[model samples]
Target chain A: NAGVTQTPKFRVLKTGQSMTLLCAQDMNHEYMYWYRQDPGMGLRLIHYSVGEGTTAKGEVPDGYNVSRLKKQNFLLGLESAAPSQTSVYFCATRQGGAKNIQYFGAGTRLSVL
Target chain B: QQQVKQSPQSLIVQKGGIPIINCAYENTAFDYFPWYQQFPGKGPALLIAIRPDVSEKKEGRFTISFNKSAKQFSLHIMDSQPGDSATYFCAAENSGGGADGLTFGKGTHLIIQP
Candidate 1:
């Protein structure tokens, strides 16, 4: 079982460029989240989806947008990338129930110059 | 504002030593606290967790000590080895708040020397 998988393991973008990061989960989890990890900043939530077709803003949702078009996939998009947006991004999923354990994907390293 | 604060941004210890990472939170509504371990180029994985009602919980060589009154929690790794060197993060969540998600600490970089 491939718990959580993120695509585009590494990317480099020029300022104002746009890109999308993909997160897929085979565990059939109902909750998915997008987070960015910066040096000495830990992981900050960018956006999240409680279930398919439902999304919400997280701690650092300003420069990103997310969509849960399907139960197995969550997409994070940056309309216009910036230098400050250069960070390692992670995708995580949790089962829908009382348990709070969140499974994470390897990660996507994005650098905006 | 940062809800969860972690101390000792970096640490080094000799093999077989004990390494403790501490975290404190300001949110009283947080009922769950968990520690995550991340290796280089990997996502953070849950190491251990504790609830506010419990003072301590242990799993293998990893332990979580929680103090409800002080809103503080810590992770203690016994018999630390070189393989145990990695970044550790502390996170808190309020189950009462629907889908709010977890607030994570800045993380602690630990190096266990051989």
Candidate 2:
């Protein structure tokens, strides 16, 4: 059912370059999130949307932006890519209600030179 | 401050052995605890979970032991196999707050030697 899908599984960008990562889900989930995973560091939430048209900052929201224009899609944008931004990004979705389980995408590996 | 702290960055265990991963949370309000397993080139998947009301929950070879009063939880993999080798993450959330996403710990790398 393609629970969660992320486009551009791999990308390389130079400093100051911009890019957008697309995440799509068919599960009709009401919440979606963006997280970055680095070595020795577990996933950290960058941004999240509770529903379409609503977004909020998580633990680490700097250097990135997110838009949930559609109920089934969440997009993460990097306005200015930096080497520190290089990490594996994951998109996850959860159903409505408290304590819902999150389903994640395979992930997008980004390398900013 | 890190809300959830996971220990032993890495572990090695022989096949058929049991590997236990521990996590402690500083926030007492957190009511939901879950463990995720991630393999190379893949996303983390829910392996097991537990609620504050329960002391332990088990499914197959994976189990979650929760200690609400102590603000600690742990994942135990019984009869570990080589296929069970993966990076495991422990996460916490105050489910009472529906919109808040999970707070994850630094993940543990488990290697099951064959």
Give the per-residue lDDT digits (tens) of candidate 2, residues A52-112.
Answer: 9999999899999999999999999999999999999999999978646999999999999
In order, the interface RMSDs are 1.7, 1.7
Lowest summed lDDT across 10 adjacent residues in model 2 chain A is found at A95-104
What are the per-residue Cα lDDT tens digits for candidate 1 across B1-114?
A: 999999889999999999999999999999989999999999999999899988999999999999899989999999999999999999999987878578999999999999
Query: lDDT for every model?
Result: 0.94, 0.93
lDDT of 2 at B53: 88
Task: Chain B TM-score per candidate, please.
Answer: 0.98, 0.97
Q: Per-prediction count of colliding residue pairs?
A: 0, 0
A28-97, model 1: which lDDT tens digit per residue? 9999999999999999999999999999999889989999999999999999999999999999999876
Question: Which CAPRI category fits model 2?
Answer: medium
Residue A91, model 1, lDDT: 97
Range of the 10 consecutive residues with the lowest summed lDDT in candidate 1 chain B: B93-102
